[model samples]
Target: MKKYLLLTNEELKRTAKPYLIVVAVLMLLEFILTAAITKMHEGKIETFMRENGVSMQEAIDAYGKSSFAQVVASGPFLLILGAGMMVILISAFVIWYRDWFGKTNYIYRLLLLPGSRSSIYFAKLTTIVLLMFGFVAIQWLMFFVLAPLHDLLLPPELFERVSIAAVLERSGLMYLYDFYLPNFALIYLFALLLIVFIFTLVLIERSYRKGKKVIRIFLQFVILGAVYGATLLVINSDHLFANEKGMLFLAFTFLYLAFLVIIGLRTVSKKITV
Candidate 1:
């Protein structure tokens, strides 16, 4: 366990910089775009309220109130969503490469070491999962810095009307500290399961190198399609036994992952050449 931890830490040390740099730059760009959109919409709000025969003070209040929602709800929220998805997508690639490339590069170096092969795979998988969690953390920190600016242009009465404090609280921004660690762990676990599924497919391919890699990919696609079909058939047809439909699919996937893992272990243990 100690050796596995050390190995994961070593891999993270090598990979963190490029991942951090790319995610940071993309987040900065999101913040800038959101800021620009907020300013433009603020101007439009002021003009529209003035033209509607609103008194100067009322127009000012109206413009600020309307624009505040846009700033918080539309601009920053949408950017946050995009940033989150990008981080996840990039994290997926990070996991894929860590297992695929990282293993291959140091294959002989580590394979000959007197350690468990499954331990090596699990350690690399754990490292990739944690790296992805770090990616989510940095993304949140980036957006946290921009949240205050979202309220900067709002009038005091407008803030009171919309209840900015309660709004922020409900929006999960004020309770960020409370939710941060939990959400990070939740998302990390979800991502870990998903990537493990993908890793299972990859290893299943490696298990049958006597056939073309394309064939393995095709097999995975067929399995995925079959799962989708079975799900749709169960969901669309009322006659399907509800309990059986759900359990059968879950049992199938669980068995599938187990089968792939077993195949992978045997292939690696047998010292098959690709």
Candidate 2:
């Protein structure tokens, strides 16, 4: 148990370091740019108010309908945050592939580790999940850092304080937070299912040596398509049967996650290769 934990922790650290650096740098840049832009807009508004002899509230009401107001409301922070998310999503594939295709071929050593081979799979899965939550934690922390900075730099009337929750709620991405945070168990199960499915596909490709590569790829697509179809059916059934969609979705997700984990373990134990 100790060895398994050590291996998992080591892999988590190795995988997380680069991502942490990138995320930190990107977030810092975003914060600086957002503050600069907010200050620029505030200065313009203040100037226009002074020149026109308009009161603060009057100036706000006049500019509030303009596109500049929208930009200030959303901020440059969301744009940079979206870009960081894209990098993190791409890192998912990189994390899995590097173990197999890196110069050292770490997967070979990983397979020879003590105890069950499925530990390697679990370790990789754990690393990905940890990195994901690490990103979330950083984003949460950014609200604290950026919110006060905005307040200090700009007048309260010029810049409304937006909480992390408020930003998410205002954006179209509110569902992401709602789905993952409040209903974490269901979301985590769904995430595990996705990870196991991707791991299974990686194993499928590795199991094949030279020939039938096209066939294996086609098989993967067909399998994934079927799974998607079945999942859609389960989701649709809730509306059709007039039942509670959340409960039904959770039950279906739990079962699907179990099935994927079983298949992933079997693939790793019996068919995976270096």
Best by TM-score: 2
Q: Number of clashing residue pairs in every model?
A: 0, 0
Per residue, candidate 1 scores C-alpha lDDT tens digits across 1-274 of 7767777786677667876786677777767755776567666666776679666467656555543335445645656655765665556455435544674656555566677767656666676667656655665565556556655644443332345455455554453334566454444444555666566565555555556667876876787678758766766677767666655555655655566556556646564333
TM-scores, all candidates, are 0.66, 0.81
For 1-274, candidate 2 gives per-residue lDDT tens digits of 6666877888877876688788879877867776787677787788879999999888888765222223324646567767766665566567668887787788878788778887777777777777666776777677677667766777667766565666666654454466555376666566556666677667667776666656876776786678768877877763555446667666766776676678778877888777
> In terms of TM-score, how similar is model 2 to the real structure?
0.81
Clashing pairs in 2: none
Computed on alpha carbons, the lDDT of every model, listed in order, comes to 0.59, 0.69
The count of residue-pair clashes in candidate 1 stands at 0
TM-score of 1: 0.66
